[model samples]
Target: MSYLYLTILFPLIGFIILAAGRDRLSENVAAIIGVGAVGLSALTTLYAGLDFYQQGGMAYNQNLWTWFNVGGFAPQIGLHLDGLSLLMTGMVTGVGFLIHIFASWYMRGDEYGYARFFSYFNLFVASMLVLVLGDNLALLFLGWEGVGLCSYLLIGYYYVNPANGWAAIKAFTVTRVGDVFLLIALFLLYQQFGTLDTVYIVENAHVVLTDSNLAFWTALMLFLGAAGKSAQIPLQTWLADAMAGPTPVSALIHAATMVTAGVYLTSRTYTVFEMAPQVLQFISITGAVTLLVAGFAALVQTDIKRVLAYSTMSQLGYMFMAVGAEAYQAGLFHMLTHAFFKALLFLSSGAVIIACHHEQNIFKMGGLWKKIPFVFACFVVGGGALAALPFITVGYFSKDAILGAVYAHGQIANLPLYNCLYWTGVAGAFLTSIYTFRLIWLVFFGQEKTHAHPIKGVTYWGPLSILLVLSTGVGALLKAPVEKLLTSAQIPVFAIPESLEHAVHGAEHTAVGIALGGLVIGVILFAFAYNAVKTIANTGFGAGISHIWRTAFGFDALYNIVFVKPFLLLARLLGRDPVDGLWLLVPALVKGGHKFTSYRQTGLLREYASSIGLGVVVLLIVLIITQVGV
Candidate 1:
């Protein structure tokens, strides 16, 4: 437990080393340092996790120092090791290390900024660790902003391309919208409670926030902040575009790090949400809507990474729905399974992209299943898990847990809204199945369209194979311990009423049928009915809808018209404003005066002497006039 800080320190040190040694370090050395740092962090998390649970999963606060003392609002720089943090730390480091190992293979020949890439990658892991492990809101926000900064850097890693740079900026700018809401939440929490300690805030929220409306507003602000980071609804446009980064960056951001931070935040502060039932309902509705939107968007995406990217948004919506339902354990459980399968899917897609000579459009490559059989198998398991194949995949268990809990919550509360949310989850699962398998079929089947290079080496297959197993039923075993841990912490959860148990079981079974049904339909449609799919996509009403879905229902364009254009127009307007011109006059006059004064200072010796004589005469005239009081 004492060595918990090492988890963050190792990665931080790795970032420093890689950053300092940028051009000096060989590829092997940089890869070793980068992968080894996260490996050490994962080991530390394992050791600390064992010790933590052995001591009965009690909340462990390791206070390192007092950050500041300000009029009784003193928050310590501390680490919090509770069930939630431990789970999150394990996921971030464990999945992150694997991604780093695979990245070494994926990014082998990049002589430009290889070490720099790993530096940003290492810092991303460390920042996420800080976010999950921090004991106070301020320290957590530091980690929060750190994650955001690294995302921007990595997303724009291929900076020679202007489009990638714009993608990075878009991601940074969009998420900051939520960050502001989060910052405001922090100030509100501090004002209301006099401290920003996470443990204290969660434990005492019910006591201090006696006004229901106050609790609702505070939680709403926090959710808004979370919604931004998690890429829900309006803030979601940045994530698909964020696929411009390296595939490993896509895996890291989508699977294990930045997107999950929002879910973690909402889950960590579950008590606050618990106090505001209305806010909780709002969260569920937002999540439900987001999942549907993202799922439909995924359906029309041609870029393989963008397909997975939208799937990530859709999956994150599930987590948000779980948290909003007061099913914290279920949400975290889904997050865990999602980390494995989504990472598998993204990294496998990376292999596909690599083998196809970086071709990203699924239609450009087919029948490569025979060419890269291992990668094909990877897609099968990963995509199957993503689609939640019944009884065989971890996603099935975790996702069902969420839907079951949501169903039970709705029935128990007798809320028609929650029941509708349960149906929304089912509909999302159906969409997930269709697009997931649609990707698999279009890329791996049909006439071979491109030559694929053979994929080999330990780094390539090792992580994928391991993640493959975890994406299966074997990974479902973790759910029990996770449930026990969170329940032990007394985090609020929705319980199914005994009377509604049968109905909940029915709901689960219905979801299973829907998932299977979607899979079968997707295979048939893409495999046998592809011409019809194509005809629909290229023609009338179907084409219009496809275009809308392709554009993520034009949220990007809508935001452009509503927000981006207006802001840019205003900026251009301000560019020539009279007020700005007024301020500009000072610099303009100063520059003019400098030009006038320097015009006579040419380097010719005769000109210099003439100027000096004229100056002397002028000085004598000025002195005579002053003396005569002119």
Candidate 2:
């Protein structure tokens, strides 16, 4: 009955109303419901948050009902909010509310899409809320799959476009592979711990699972699931293509909500990971590799959204590294900062796309700063943050914190992997600047290559302005508060490790030095990239490098050769479909046998009598043989 539970219910009701009333309600009314639902939920969260905080911010739990009861196992659908969950709730709902507002205006032009867009958007918010607030893993997975469904629905919202449709299926199918691993992990955890309750699992993981090998595999499976949802390596390719969705969808899902689900899951189950150091080591490596690859891909991307898409994957890689390195607080901090700035970038990109009449390629755009100077300026700030330009930007704090954790953890654990990650993080920062500035100058500074209609109104500028302010200042101001709130509960699961803290503490000067160094390197790359882009294709070296980056270092091609081609070749080898052929063969054999049997039954009654007498003699011979053998 608490408002905490109502946060999800409001959005669900909104989705149901908008969806069911799509035909009955007018566009404006439907739009209001869509935005209002999230807005109300945001309000509810604010109210609940204030009340909860005033009461010392303790954990709150509410059981709605027992989902089922079987023997001794019963995982109820419920809600739980501690400081961590509250923080996540604030991010999801607060950002979600703004996105809904922006989307209301963004989708206004699409005749029938207004109602449909909000419906899906609201449901997506509701699902993610359920994910972060769910009291048990079963309920969490429900929200998990819900977001996946909503993502597919939203990404392929432009179903008329074949490419969009393919991207949606790719996102859905690829994530399903991870989902399978997650389901298996859930089963394993249940087998080992005998409960799916979030609290119970974390509390009992160590007491229950003493087998180091079993723990390692379970954690690995969980990481695979996290990677799938979060778009990490091997499961990361779909994210870049997810740009096919509407811009609001990009900001909402890619930037703020669905992608972060994996991180939330990992944070909530830190104890499970705490027991498996080997798996954590693997997470660090996967994250480092994914970021480097995505950074490389971002450097050469032509489409604006794709660049942001790759940037997202790269940033996610950093979070994974943080959590893998057992810097849970650092990981969660980065997730928060990322949600603010990345969402800003995407929404700002939305405005630009609108001005350009749906043109997405930055190379095709030029000198838009003079036309929409506000958007141009916003991108600069957003770009600076994305590039992690020095101390002023929040990205520096969150990113540096993670980097420090990696170094400190590496040194403490005596694993050289963390050293490698620290360097990778630094390099990614530099490349991020190069590519981000490349996007900025290409679209806003160069000679006008394509004329764009100017964007003029508060609807476009309002959200961008608010986000710009938050992206710039949020991290610096919230640093101490975030650390305190997250570690306040002081449970071992959410606690910042002493080794990681000492490393971060010792490496303070190193972090500042790295930030400054990365900034300077980024600036140099920016100048070089900005100038080289003009004639890169004409020069041999430039052309080759450009081709490599343009191809996303051949990940797309790798998938084709490794997965797609083999699948097609298999289909060719069994053109009829092997299982389908088996079904056809059954009918064919029956017909052939019937034909053979029919021939034995001649039309003449004497033929029937001869066949019956022959059958009887054959049966007698078989019986005699059987008796002799026995």
Q: Whose TM-score is greatest here?
A: 1
Q: lDDT value for candidate 2?
A: 0.85
> Judged by lDDT, which candidate is best?
1
TM-score of each: 0.92, 0.90
C-alpha root-mean-square deviation, each candidate: 6.8, 4.0
Residue 153 displacement (Å), model 1: 0.5
Candidate 2 pairs with clashing backbones: none
**Per-prediction tally of clashes:** 0, 0
lDDT of 1 by residue, 10-53 (tens): 99999999999999999999999999999999999999988988
Clashing pairs in 1: none
lDDT against the true structure, per candidate, is 0.92, 0.85
